[model samples]
Target: MKLLASGVFALATLMASSALAQAQAPANYGPAIPGVCVYYGAQTLAQSTVGQSVSTRMNALSQEVAGELAPYAQSIETEITALQQGRASIPPAELQSRSQAVEQRIREAQQLEQTRQNELRYTLDVQRRAIATAVDPIIVAVYQERGCGLLLDRESVYLMNPAMDITPTVIERLNVALPSLSFNRLQVPVDQQQAQ
Candidate 1:
């Protein structure tokens, strides 16, 4: 078993509730939680690298909606700009018709954006929960081994006692014990109702 630093912020954030659980633990009852250690872990660096891919996936999903709406957006903006530049003067009949059409198109784009946003948001929420679930068993193993009373997100702790640091060890053990959720899973569109 490799040693793990428990205070890495990346893993810590996901395990913050465990920190509170630690505080509530009975004092001097070490026997009850043998092999338990007070620990934290970082996975931010790794997760951030994965996030770049996630970002790209989100941008790609936006493409379809954007494509559908681009002509409307572009046309409206062009007409507005032309009006500002005095490039075109419209009679009241044409002006009213153009204004209504522009409003309708704008609404369509806004609706599409809202739908896409909801789908992506739901997908992200599920994915994070999945990753957090994957890491839990490793946490339990380390807790059992170290006689740990609590676990915290590494980011929350400012001072690292080398004696207490177990990040690398935990990470290694976790890699073996638990398969990581996709470091970057592309979020695709879902129906607006399903997204909700």
Candidate 2:
């Protein structure tokens, strides 16, 4: 019985020691290290000179499309007016033919407008992506220059040291590296289309 009691006490002591060791061991929290810089991409883009240039170019393109569509708008209105006034005087067959022609023209104009809008949207997206890509090497250069081991997006962090914020520095670097991107429409590579 004494031996049994001694054995139980020894087992309890070993269990306690194991628990204490585990409590002292450092937790495996993730790959994040101390003193890494974080940047807000949206803020950086908005403040960058290239971003403003892109916005201005997009606005100009929109205005140009609107001006180009103005004549079609007037023609469509005139066609509608003519159809309404000639409904009684025009023979049934002639009226039907005119109606179909007017509908086809209107559809064509709408399709043309839609195509223009899509092209503009695609061009703007491509430009924005190009700007982001151009800024990537700059981001790496800045991160290395600042001696930060890690660079992360500001959105993921809830709180951080103000000194660890690198957005302003990144924006400055981007301004020097790339002042503006091409605002013109991007052409899809013909080789890529053929491959598809």
Best by lDDT: 2
Across residues 1-196, which tens digit of lDDT does each residue of candidate 2 receive? 2222353465467457546755664554345455588977866656689876776676677777788888998998898899899899999999899899989989989977766666666676788788889888888887888788878887687555556778888898888888986666444455733543
The C-alpha TM-scores of every prediction are: 0.57, 0.70
Position 51, candidate 1: lDDT: 33
Error of 1 at 192 (Å): 9.4
Lowest lDDT sum, 10 consecutive residues, model 2, at: 1-10
Clashes of each: 34, 0
| Candidate 2: stretches off by over 4 Å | 1-33, 157-161, 186-196
- How well is each residue in 31-144 modelled by candidate 1, as lDDT tens digits? 433332344433422433333334345445455546756777788798667655653667767777777777787788777666555555555556556545655676677666
How many clashes show up in model 1? 34
Return the top candidate by TM-score. Answer: 2
Which runs in model 1 stand beyond 4 Å of their true positions? 1-72, 82-88, 173-196
